[model samples]
Target: MKINLAALQIASVLALGGCTVLPPQPAPAPRGGTATPAPKPQLPAPPPRPAPPQPQAPRADAANWRDLPQTPGSWTYSAESSGSAVRFGQPGAGPLLAIRCDRTRPAIIVQRAGFGTGTVPATITTSSTLRRLTATPTASAAQNAAVAFEITFAVRDPLLDAIAFSRGRFMLEMGGAQTLVLPVWSEVGRVIEDCR
Candidate 1:
């Protein structure tokens, strides 16, 4: 009744010699044994912090249209930065450039106009600055005095921020990680050419 093979190879070599895969031995510095201070280089826990670079779309300035301006004012301005929404208007005579991109983020605007029999009104033009700032997207022809405009700004889901501040444009928060483009019209964006 004691053939030993039934002992399952001596109980599997005494349970594999008391189970030892060896990798957890840090408890022998007591009983007045003093020297146990060399285990603090565990920085592999910092690779989980790579999600802060999702803040793109702010590195652009290749527009110098001779630095923009030569009178086109009677202005109105409003500001909101990051979450985007702004309003501005300029009209002192012959033509005008009024903007209100009410924020679902679809924007670009430039102005300084009158084309056919021009005199002194035409220095810049860019469009789609909406907030109902429309004149029939050009009621007759794409007349201009000077121009440079772009579009793709949208408001219905503009990456979504509560329907883009409810189409009234709000959310340009400033401070920390730093982001602000409320140029409200930077000194009239050189006199109305690029509405950055």
Candidate 2:
């Protein structure tokens, strides 16, 4: 019986040794050979960037008063209890030039809007006459104006008539301001006539 048992154990051991377990092997690569690493899981492309903005050029400044274009405005008149005024500019804008009358003193005040200090010479040139006058810093008279030079004329001054009756137009000039080529309009005559 002992011999039979020992023979049985030996047979079991031989069977187990012949049927030993082994890890599973991978399948052989395809015939194409250069196994393309399974196209790495494709990802979406990033968005494109925008172009940079361009810079703008600066505008050129006018060298002198004559380089400026002629102002396309006309004279307008208004009356107040203190006096009457004839202004030269656009209807809704401030006047570039103004002739104000003071009823109490009975004088004509000619003002030109500009920038300067102290007294300077102002000229008004007509076809027949050219009058040069001193324009002092007269900011008090021109309320709401930035800076102005003004000259006073008596109501009977002949310069008023020359300005009113000049041939078609007249020119006003100052040292540091644009020249104004103003038309000889009836408004100027009316102001003169009313002041007198």
Best by lDDT: 2
Report the error of model 1 at residue 32, Å: 99
Q: Which stretches of candidate 2 lie over 4 Å from their true place?
A: 1-70, 140-145
lDDT of 1 by residue, 39-134 (tens): 898766555555566754432122432133333334454454522223333444433333334333334333222233212221112221212122
Could you give candidate 2's per-residue lDDT for residues 47-110 as a string of tens digits?
A: 8878886863211212232334456898889997878999999878888899888888989988
Task: Evaluate all candidate structures by whole-model CA lDDT and list the values in order.
Answer: 0.34, 0.78
Using TM-score as the measure, the top candidate is 2
Which residues of candidate 1, in runs, are more than 4 Å off?
1-69, 72-74, 78-95, 111-137, 141-196
Every candidate's CA RMSD = 17.6, 20.7
List the lowest-lDDT window of 10 residues for candidate 2: 57-66
* Candidate 1, residue 160: how far the Cα is off, in Å: 20
What are the clash counts of all predictions, listed in order?
11, 0
